[model samples]
Target: MKKINLENKTILVTGAAGFIGANLVLKLLHEVSRINIVGIDNMNDYYDVGIKEWRLEEIKTKADDNSTDSSWTFIKGDIADKEMVDKIFSQYHPDIVVNLAAQAGVRYSITNPDAYIHSNLIGFYNILEACRHSGDDSGKKVEHLVYASSSSVYGGNKKVPFSTDDKVDNPVSLYAATKKSNELMAHAYSKLYNIPSTGLRFFTVYGPAGRPDMAYFGFTNKLLKGETIKIFNYGNCRRDFTYIDDIVEGIYRVMQGAPDQKNGEDGLPIPPYAVYNIGGGRPENLLDFVDILQQELLNAGVLPKDYNFEAHKELVPMQSGDVPVTYADTTALERDYGYRPSVDLRTGLRNFAEWYKKFYID
Candidate 1:
């Protein structure tokens, strides 16, 4: 393994206004000094653009509050635009690149396959191509390329905890298929260009200022509107609900410890590439998770104390692109990075609920 010193390094983070990306920028600003950080985001209206803007504001506030020798630059642009991607690479010449700008949400992929292909596939290709040529002329190469994968790649496998070694050719949704493709593309790029790369298969990540498309956030919205919230698989789902903070911490740790390039017996360069599952090892039942979420809503004053939760929920059969369970085997992450998600569902939901009250209700 190779240890990367983040201090004085130039890092480019795509999807800078996103939930994970914003938090990661904040973390970098707080933890690493004398760093030059560049961020880019399309700021699509897939969810509320307000949320993305708000996250950017938070990052800006943090950058201002920190009196250290760190800097942040944000560009509103799309990675799918090869010209724009190439411009950023040529101008910044970042040492580390984190690609998190892909179109998210499995169900959304079913209705809008074009978005997935455009961003997930083509955008990723552009990033890889740019990384491949970053060293040309500039003589400065990207040290590590980290990108996001999804647990949905596990598909309908009956595995308890999905491992990195697990077969993921069978993706249930276009989103999953695209994420799987990302891992494959990264592997090929690593082999061809000897670029150090890592892919994280994130489980159901949740927390404050999270994506509103996620279940907990959407459920809060529905409950607040006195509408029914559908529980998929007739309340038989189990999910590894990893918190945003934990996910950010995992990414931070993984960024500094890139896989080392090696030479094989055939006198060929082996790819310095790896993939790991970043998740809370424990899986929580969907029904129990909802129960805790409601309790937290009440505790946070987002929901009335006497609200009738039982009347606002309905059990429904699984959707077309939905799976019954998503459990991640994070043993490899812990083994390699010495870290695993530790936040529990209740605490995570509580934080989200409190944030909801502050953001909307209050």
Candidate 2:
């Protein structure tokens, strides 16, 4: 794998105002010096645009407070627009591109499959195409293209620990199918264009200031409103609930290490591509996870200790496109990067609870 030098490099992060994207940009700006980051997002109202705007503000605050050596530039545009994407690539000529903008929600995909096709497929294709031509007219080349994939791609796998090597052919939801297609598309692009790419299959990512669409954040919102929180699959399911900080850490490490560019004896580009599961290795049961969340909420004063937890929780059958379990085999991530997501549910929930209290309640 080719190791990249972070100094004086321009990194382009799509979905920069989004949850993970904003957090990733904040981390990069704080930690790395002498680097410029260009962020692109259509800033569509998939959820609360207010939160997205707030995150962008937070990034600005963090950037201002942190190292003076780093800088950030945000462009309000969609990657699916070929002209917009081409313009950004032409303007910045980013040495690295992290594609995170996508129509994210599995349930949302049922009602709107076109969003998935437009963003995940076409948007990603434009990114690959941009990277393919990035080196043109300029000596600067995109050394790495790290993109987001979802554990939903594992889709009904009977396996306990979902390995990257697992066959993800049977995607139950349009979201999963799109994510799986990204991996396949990345592979083809890597082989054809030799664009070193790494796809991260993220498991249930939860943290403070997170997506309102996600279960944890949504549950908090409902509980605060004295509404019933639906526990799908009768709370029998399990998930590798990775925290936002851990996910960003994994991404930062992967950004520096691109899959080794090697050629076959046949003298063709050997597809410098890799996939890793960035997840909590320990899969916590849904009920247990909820319990931890409740405790943390109470601890953070987001919920009273005497709050009627049972009254707010509604255990229901699993929704279509939802899985019974998602367990990640982080052997490859650990072996290669010497790091795997280790944040426990309680600890992670505590952080979220604190953030929720500060951001929403307090």
Candidate 3:
């Protein structure tokens, strides 16, 4: 992998404590020289604050290594707070801004829709405003703004291998709706301010120290406790399960290679913005995924060999905001960046099992 030069560049990564944010920050710090990173996360107990703190601890340990003079600064703040966001932008004047903070979870949005509005809507607005105004004082505008979108925006479309050109106006859930809205808002901002914004519609990202609310992590816990794991939609679903490392790698590549103006029919730069699907591109069956996960847990010593795994799985009706299948079309990403996620599901599951054993079982 050819590493890009990011020396002397200050970058701001929101949702630093989240799974993807932490991974991206660690990768950037180790790869870039003389780089300064400012990470902000409210550290809400949406899952476990301890896990978030542990991720920060790992980042701090790497940053303190004397071999690299690169700096990592963390701030406990919310993106919705305009005053605090403005202050950080003014102080750091980051060359690149990556916004990964948002109210996640699809089903949760059904009951708690307001959270999505506050974070995804108001919070993202605050980030855009800060990025736009950051250069006013120092005349150093943010070169690129990369934000997280989701594959859920595809909704109930019957299309295989969802592409950026596909119409995503029909969002099934509030979470998907907000994500789609983010893309639209980013397009407008990119056209108006030339922010060179890139929105990544990530598929099902899972790996070590992932969110507990996710099916893989939650099912692991249920299996360990000898409890029945609810297999929603009768385990007839398919997901493009992207590994965390793959996602981090994709983000790093897209960050370095910002979107450029493509000539439109009028022979002028079109939108100066782009959206790409960062996913495994290979969808795995839900039941097959669970079977591999069970074997991995046993291999990691988190599950007994004779455990009643079959009896533990309870088939249930489809849950709201849950899609039957999701597949990604990575042609755009491959053509532009020569990058494609190569992590297989079994390998990724094994890595997660190892981490789960060490973190919870040990």
1-362: candidate 2 lDDT, tens digit per residue: 78898879999999999999999999998789888999989999889998899999999898778765888898999899999998889889999999999999999999999999999999999999999999896867799999999999999999879998888899999999999999999999999989999999999899878999999999889999999999999999998889999999999999999999988999988999999999988888989989888989899999888999998888899999999999989889988887767677888889989988988877
| Residue 66 in model 3: lDDT | 30
lDDT of 3 by residue, 1-362 (tens): 12235788899999999999999999988888888999999999889998999999999989988355799999999998999999999989998899999999999999999999999999999999987787899999888889999999999878898988999888999999999999989988877666778899999999999999999999998888889999989988999999999999999998887777455687655666879999999999999999999999999989988888978989998898899999999998898888799899999999999999899879
Better of 1 and 2 by lDDT: 1
In model 2, the runs with Cα more than 4 Å from the true position are none
Candidate 1: where are CA atoms >4 Å away?
none
The model with the greater lDDT, 2 or 3, is 2
List candidate 3 segments past 4 Å from native: 1-4, 261-270
C-alpha lDDT (0 to 100) for residue 154 of candidate 3 = 98
Alpha-carbon TM-score of each model against the true structure: 0.99, 0.98, 0.96
Question: What do the candidate models score in CA lDDT, each in turn?
Answer: 0.94, 0.92, 0.91
Ranking by lDDT: 1, 2, 3
Residue 140 lDDT (model 1): 99
Please provide the root mean square deviation of candidate 3 (C-alpha atoms, Å): 2.2
